[model samples]
Target: MAQRSPLDLPEGDPFGPDNLPYGVFTTSDAPHLRKIGVRYGAHVLDAGAAAATAASPHAELLGASSLNPLMAAGRPVWQAVRAELRDWLTNPAHRHAIEPLMHPLTTLALHLPIEVADYVDFFASEHHASNAGKIFRPDGDALTPNWKHMPIGYHGRAGTVLVSGSPIVRPHGQRLPPAEAPASPAPASAAPTPAAPSPSASSAPPRPVFGPSLRLDFEAEVAFVVGAPSPLNTPLPLAGFHDHVFGVCLLNDWSARDIQSWEYRPLGPFLGKSFATSLAAWITPLDALAAARTAPPARDVPPLPYLDDAAAEPGGFDLRIEVAVNGHTVSRPPFSAMYWTAAQQLAHLTVNGASLRTGDVFASGTVSGPRPDELGCLLELTWGGRDPLHLPHGTRTFLEDGDEVTLTAWAPGPDGVRIGMGEVTGHVVPAAS
Candidate 1:
């Protein structure tokens, strides 16, 4: 766990800070996927090939080829492989085991971390809730009647989730303002001016306009990868939630804010959330992050019995998370302030026996806090951009076309080597003309 030197990295640094996560990769010249690999520096230490030669319990998971077989083998196998991999890569002289299959991370391409079975996005951050409340009901309350009762979430479309680096096409949808107040005719006593046609009658058709949204937005969050499958009616104890999660990744839940505000009242986010979502390619194993876990803040009201985990650990990861527009890091503060924890959400998810499968994604919602600078999204950081945020490139209330958003996170640990989650980025394309 000590910080590795740059030389260790160049010798195919398997323990590089940003490369702590794992994912399948294939080089352009490789025929038919045949190995598993972990990102380190700019190289991938081919896990599959290394296991073939190394004497480790993980050899079975790395058998012959593609990572899909290993990934589907579930959590126990993943943990075994992670342990073996860390040992093989960290020892300076282990190249005899890893040399032949090694390749630069840049030359290879990342694949979808998993074949996601389902996706659920949770609104578990209190700061995010309060900020939204200020916009929707500024005059009254922050927490809703049902908010403190349980974590609120919506099932998301898994088919639409894409890996980092994929281009996001602008989504087209209907947009409209509230109906205008009716106009009144001039008073007879005023000797009315020439009569005018009714404004409403002369307006354009009311059908949905087809063009990319003008108010596209992004939600920065942490996602849990479900490793173990569950039965349809079994409830998982709050403390046991960790057993089912494989690892974690950074995610950007893209949104069409304008459309969301208009349509969410009836049932909640649909198209606004359905278009696209991008996730960090590498997945940081949960075991590696377990050492960094810290306690979350207490809720004012007592949680429902099933929702409470009396034995739950008091801390979450101490990761420093940030967002960058195009390539410029935003002025907002880091991610230490999130009010909700992923464990609580997962525990509640199966309270009724809802089956969970490997590859299911659960997002932490937008992480924000009391500090104005720590706000997670433009809607909060800018107070609706009533005040624009200054960036090295300029200032922005929200994203603009050709703009790219990137998210990165890291935590300091033993030695000089810090574990990190690589960047997840996406660019804004112009709306259809």
Candidate 2:
């Protein structure tokens, strides 16, 4: 009896013919040479080789070392290439030519799929933002004034965006000391007490001290990859989202909560967030997730005309995400719970005439839901460290050296199948001296 083919996957495999995510990989025999590959069940097909074997017109695009060139080719080309690849895999006539190009996934080393141009992260989840505001400012409003009016985002350091499995060096930075307790109220002896004098320089609040961050955390997010470039000073509307975006992937936006808390006032995130961000190697194409599209949550405030997506296609993805630490599942953030949709984010990002690049990446900030188990990051799960999470290994308020965090997700796919977004994982190492 002959052994079953790797392509003959079990029913309902997340990575089926309906979901052919792309990535870059290398083999031990030629570690220096990188090639674009498409995942198929337990194997990765050398896409370029298969295209070359089939004498495909898009062979050059498929054969590139990086996904940038193909992604820059625009939407029509993307659809055509995807159609051809699917036909080659599903059609028995091309199986003989394609099967030889399939390589075992375990034997390959995956790499960053694209050359990142610019990275932006958005605070898109209402639950997450509310939780954060409540944790950091107990006496203030949970959501900011302009939060519902538009998508709040900040530019991130693209150079630090790394592929999954990379080691994260805990960042070093200044952190404010714990707040001093209020002095007991003086006895009500005087009818009217004079106001205390303003604090002098010598009596100023405690100064920040430099050290390794004590509150390391991970934010589970989903990100979109840009495909086509746009002209400078031209705005892309919400309807143009699919025209420019190529695919989606899982993202782990690593953060130093202590460093952020000390420096985030007045200005937004700086060194605390610029250290490291992990991206999954596999990028599931937008076309593969057609079944996952769903209506976004109803907005409490009416959106501005430019960001309005009321008449657009369902702008939210029904992705179910799982966040784990050291092999223990902790949170299950639902992508569908995000208050702001990806289309709205794209429109808001380009509304000011900012251009789009082929490899530009923008992530949905910390996907979280209303349930206790649905929080995306340690900052919320541990409730600002007041409540420690009791994992099987031990209790944890935040990440420790050698701790590994992984994020994985799946969306509904065509014909009741599931579309896998793969996973982004990183291990924390001690900070540098």
Point to the candidate with the largest TM-score. 2
Native-to-model Cα distance after best TM-score fit, residue 216 in candidate 2, in Å? 0.4
- Tens-digit lDDT string for candidate 1 (1-433): 8743422666323356334577777778874574566776766777766777885666766653434455556777877677777677767687555655667666887777677889998887777787776654556576677777888888889999988887776787755443521121111010112223345866854444545665677778888888778888988877776678888888888887655544454467777778898988888877767656777776687888877755677536667778888777663534556556677788788887898887889988777767776767777766654677787777777677888888888765555456777678888877656
Candidate 1's C-alpha runs over 4 A off are 1-7, 10-19, 31-35, 55-57, 63-74, 178-208, 331-334, 392-394, 415-417
Q: Which residue pairs in candidate 2 have backbone atoms (N, alpha carbon, C) closer than 3 angstroms, thus clashing?
A: none
Across 355-383, the per-residue lDDT of candidate 2 in tens digits comes to: 99989999999899999999999888988
Superposed by TM-score, candidate 1 places the C-alpha of residue 425 at a distance from the truth, in angstroms, of 0.7
**lDDT of model 1 at position 32:** 59
Superposed Cα deviation of residue 20, candidate 1 (Å): 3.7
Reference-based TM-score, model 1: 0.86
TM-score of candidate 2 on Cα atoms, chains taken together: 0.95
- Give the alpha-carbon lDDT of every model: 0.69, 0.88
Error of 1 at 148 (Å): 1.5
